[model samples]
Target: MNKSNNKLNKIIDYIRKDNGINNAIEATEQASLLLILKYFYDNSFSNTIDKLPPFSKVFLKGYKSHQSRNGTGYLTLNNIFDERIKSNSSFRSFKKLEEFLALVPFRVHSIKIVEVILHILDEIQVDESLADDYDNLIVSMTNSSISSGAFHTPIALVSALVKVSKPNKMQRIYDPAMGTGRFFVESQKLVKDDFLHFRGNDLSAFACLIGSVNLLLNGICIDNINIEDSFLYEDNKKYDLIYSGVPFGKPSDISKYGHEYHDYKNSLEGMFLKHTMDKLALEGKAVLIVPDGLLSNMTNGFKDLRYQLLTHFNLHSILSLPSGILLPYTSVKVSVLFFDNSPPDEDVWYYDLALNKNINKRTPIKEDDFSEFISLFEKREVSERSYLVNKKSILNDRLFNLSIPLPTNEETIKFDKAQEIAQLNSENLKLFSSITNYFDVTSRDIKVENTDIRTIKSLGNLKTGNNLTKSELLGNGSFPVYGGNGIIGYYDKANRDENTIIIGKVGLYCGNIHFSEEPFWLTNNAISLEIQDTSRVFAPYLAHLLRGLDLNKLSTGAVQKFVSIKKLNDIEVSLPSYEKQVELSNYFNELEQAKSSLDKLLSSFNEGISLLNKNIILEKVIN
Candidate 1:
């Protein structure tokens, strides 16, 4: 391994300390940078940092302080984070942290603090022997530009995508805002020294170092990786399999770009797309991780990017990722844009990875709670694939990309001329999806001869659950309550008995799922899906069946998250008579017992893999 890579990893270890920093993004960035400086000093590339300039020393100190404040001092200029939250109520959609985001604009809007820190590092004194420690330090710190320690698209998600949506192989891949080199790392072919091909860029020099190191560690060549602010037209590189998880929001006007683009606060993602196309080799492919707001931003900026993408690339697919992918900090819904440099294809394969559960936004891979989504998306059945009414297919009329028409019918419609004859169809999708997809079925599917749903609805006005002290703990309930991620002890008070069938009032856990009925309490975080109908509704049996169904898509919340009780009733449970409900519930009770036994067997299987230490691979990967 190169001295630089070694140095960076050491610094990252010291700063991150594994258990120390929860955010993965910081660990990668800080580790790489400190290593570079140490490598330069230790390898005799440069003498003491003090041998040169004075300002550089101050930059190092200031950067250290900033990162320590939040351990993101090196590159993230978070001065304006607190201020951005206070901009106004228009941006004040979140009730819990209204003031925090409002202040982002005021505190550290520009990267000046980071720039100064960089300047200082450029001129500071250095110690050669401490290279390893320094490298570890750099990697552990969080970054301001991108949320440090993000839940990147899982490797399984990518591999499944490759299998289902087979793209042309032998094409070069690229990540424009490659933070810690996630997408690239997953693409590297096993048993091979290099990726079939790859390239990437990042704003932070620290991030670049980490990304570069990550690439090298994966056995990919270092020369292919470029560390620079890709948005500034930095690396004149190109590729085919371009995969990126770029940051969102409007573009900034840096003096480096000159004044013509001064008022550029549009989709930074859109700008990345333009850049991706700019450097893309002939017939290159790109899969961009973008925000959902961009899909319907309606701004000319969005329209322009969408139109340009349609013309230059074959818009292959749009996979709308589940919400809460990056939660506890951010709740922005993200989508994947998969396209190729070639002309338009016959049809765009749009899939929705229906991940709607909230995740505890802690670090050290805190996302493990929802991590099961990887397997689910991978298991999503292929074929039975319809553009409209398919059950397994996440993208039916519910998703908007279905707007594009198949040209097969164009000759039949020579006189109709659909493109010019009709208007854009975004509004139609939202309206139809709201009324039909979420509702109608789940609500009206119930057919009662004697008892009405009112019996279940009258469980003495649902009481709220506990008010958690730690906001991060909000998603991590010990045992789930009525909702998707709440626990039993996390309750305020229970007006009803223990056997009450609690329902998820908000999110997808609404219609189905019952809680532990042994004198347990539900959290205010979840609406108790109670049923007063003791005569008809077999709560446990119903909960089991309903739990199988996803109810999050029908949820409705404005600022504070919530689901409608009226809409939740539409779900029709396959209640097999009162005898069957009891028999099935009894059968399920036994099944649960059997599952525990099977779970133990599965647990034993994992024991071997768990015993195999990750550090063992270090020797093979490094040299």
Candidate 2:
């Protein structure tokens, strides 16, 4: 086997090895090494991955074993780790992190390599808390790799603008969340080598490791790095360029370590926006990634944040991020936040990427789609791109320009009243035929992939919709009660939370499915499918490929909107082979297990935040 895979297996074996009853530190150390190496090598933070030899058999066995247990697929696994360090320079104190962040190779590679060694050290019971600090930092970063890769901003989009758009050299660059330092890496291509140094805050100590490695890989010196609690810690610093992807809504009390976070009465985005502005130079440029909800929220607080961002910064341009662009794991809508430290320009350039689309839960994400956004954003021929000018033009066009609409009187008005308006007038109407069509094809294309089973597949039990009481409907619980318009309300008591998923049987919501973790009550609005015998079939596995991406393209009935099992069973099934189907199903089942493991942590999300305050990692298995 190849060296990397061998190493990976060794790491896995170390994590959960069966060495005489209780697990030994050897396995934990190995798992630790795996985590660190994966984080640093990923994203070319270190330049040596492409050349690593194949990992060993024991390592390979462990690698496959962990993968089997984790249910992580090829793309997801591939995105998790890489050893491609490209540059590096040393720095002092806080700047060491920045310098490394700016030119991340040495630090990235070193961190990964050292983390593994440290895991070994931890296994040998090393006493270096400082090394442990760095190790923890790497672990923190590795855990979020799925999301880090998800939000990778291509240099193609931001490179040219950083050089030409902003007219100042020696700029200061900063990111609030700073996952793997995409903004810094992208900025390096556009801005002068020494034009700016990196400054950013992150709740994830692991992201700190990622940014640090990314900076080192880019050839930035570590001495320039400034690490701190961005919201609470004051460095009294200022800069000419600010780039960041501050997280979405406030992650309230989501930590167990009793760390305090920004208690924004408003959304988390607003707080980050203000935080970014607080660090901006008089004529600096700030590029942020914000949600559509922020731009369109009618709340006075949101308006104030916009107003503040506008008055302090030029509010230059708003670029809409393609849907499903952030995470295949999630479908949050996002937009580019471009503005300068000066007053508003005559008109903001709004470039909508036609190639960009919404988050398609139907498909798994890859480098291809997100990379497309970067390429599209980099194309500067704004006039050629579809950008809305006045509110009239925007309303008349019937599309949401991923770009920020020029903040004209009408444009601003439309934004503040965006979600409130109900009239679908020509001024506000959208043809949206293509969007509907896409969803149509996606929902219609069913991959019935388990039909040719040779084994005795039998129904375990078919449960009908429960007669949920009206009072139960009004109760204060979070179990999803599926009905018209999907999850209409909450059910106090749940009937089936684990192992069963609900499918809409009637109405416009027909055919839609919900994954439940508890005994959720289903109203007459949906149908629940439970597998009986799996010698021939495993229902959940079949349900996996069928749930969201399957079923009818059209709503059931105009009046009742109902779908029967007969109709569902009649929809084509695409079973590759009984064995393969079961294999694939088992893989998906493992994924559910891992997800279930993570979901249990949600209850302690607030507790995690507390830990963050004290500079700790929560809910993570430490090597």
Candidate 3:
């Protein structure tokens, strides 16, 4: 076992050192192909030799001859490589290899590299356990680059989904967006049935190639893998089980699907959901990892989709995963939805797998972490982490929001608190205008007096904050980390100490203004303001002024709106005198103090009301 692990590590080290591979995705793909070839070559000598392609022997023979002469022999392996791949084109699983090879950069040292890798593979004994070693190799390579590894699902997540769904013998399984075939490989470990058939598809030909190789490494030869966008294409065959981690946030051009999907023409999640529903067999179950927005979004499209899910399918359970589950790639919170084609259930089970520990690349989710969840899942018992919500409540009260509902006691407290806060905020806004009336009047007077207009550059220096990865942010850190919006998470250290004005520098929240009084860490997603002349411009006052200007209009980028520091610096503002500015700042401070007092009063009021209500109930019961 140690020797096999060492060989796998050696292969990963070799690929990482190769200059030809630009990223982890490329390195992993190359390693997968080499490993698959070795697996098949070794199997060619066994009783299952007939399943191997005829060209397999020829390919290995030519590779060995070329290696013997140190890659300088006149063996002409390029033609052999092309011929072998072409010969396998008739096979569904291997046809995508041609496209995958075209994308891979086979450099001058490629043959020598392959030879070294093949020699190591030959040393390791080929067995069913070897597939796991190959999976570990892929995981190691993919972790080197986050963006490149975004498609690969973490094994722990896959195992949890598999265990929850519970694959059985003689079942047909399918994954529409099967990246590297992790779901299939994990499922195979439990079922171990010859009748268990696997089918999958992916948009990227490279992904299809790697997925095919992954399945083959595990002694599972699937013939129905395809390289096509699952959203646009329609598969007629129904499956017993479907599992997928569909793409989120990317709007698809679903015009080709016709007018029935007019509302969901741009929503990729909606399309995938509709497609999955259509493809399920009479009792087929689907386990999907979807973004949290799909559950609570008020869009007409999302509401309609959720309504269909509740009414048509037997929605089983929802597992809310942690936020940083897909860290470094994206911090979007996701949940698993389990449903089947049977009669609809009146209530749906929900398990909140809220982990206290931070989940990142270094510390990932594990199957064992879900031990309590798995034990309670079958009975659908109510506990601190799990609950049940009726379908009527979801449709009538929530407007089809499927997000896990907060506990009754907690929900009432939060709703009361939020109502109080909203009222206070509305009153505060009114008071803000009255206090800052001097500035508004001064600006109007300046227009008549023809006073000099001051640019932000003259008042302060604007610079983007430093970049910090999601992994760097801690769950229980000392300081908040501000992103494009407000504080995204907490960090261990602070980059800015004083009260500073920040503007969202990119994406959806571009040009949104925020004022941070406490020390905080700032990311490049926002631009911070350092007042050069504090006497003339108070930070809070400047933030309020910029908010009125509608700075989002200055944002650039057709797809992802962003505002550069130069654009912010060029924004013109009508500044009042220093004394007037200080007076306005003082008023703003007093308004904040008033709001703080209101919060304290509301807290006391809530406690008193709770005690009074309890006493009333107890008195009525005694009487």
lDDT tens digits, residue span 1-623, model 2: 43343443454443343332112222332343334333333323234345533223223444445456655422122222222222322112332333323322211112244345334433331112223233333333223322333224433344533543453446667776776566666666455555556666665444555455455545544354444556766578887778776677544333421232233444667677777787788888787777777764544566556655544456656666567655532467777777777876544456554453444433323344344334544453334443323332322222212224323223223222323233222212232443343344435333545355322123434355766655567645667676633566786667664667577765334677665655667775577766554465555566777664645454443112356666554454444655776667776666566555444443244233222321211111111
Give the winner by lDDT: 1 or 3: 3
> Best by lDDT, which number?
3
Q: List, residue by residue over 121-147, the lDDT tens digit for candidate 1.
A: 443334433333433332233322123
Candidate 2 residue spans exceeding 4 A from truth: 1-169, 189-196, 224-227, 253-266, 356-384, 388-623
Off by over 4 Å in 3: 44-115, 122-127, 252-262, 408-414, 417-623
- Model 2's alpha-carbon lDDT is 0.48
Top candidate when judged by TM-score against the true structure: 3
Q: Give all candidates' CA lDDT scores.
A: 0.47, 0.48, 0.71
TM-score-wise, the better of 1 and 2 is: 2
Superposed Cα deviation of residue 425, candidate 1 (Å)? 18
TM-score of 1: 0.42
Assess every candidate by TM-score: 0.42, 0.44, 0.63
What tens digits encode model 3's per-residue C-alpha lDDT throughout 115-194?
Answer: 66666766765556777776776677556655445467888889878887889766788888887898988898877654
Q: What is candidate 2's TM-score against the reference? A: 0.44
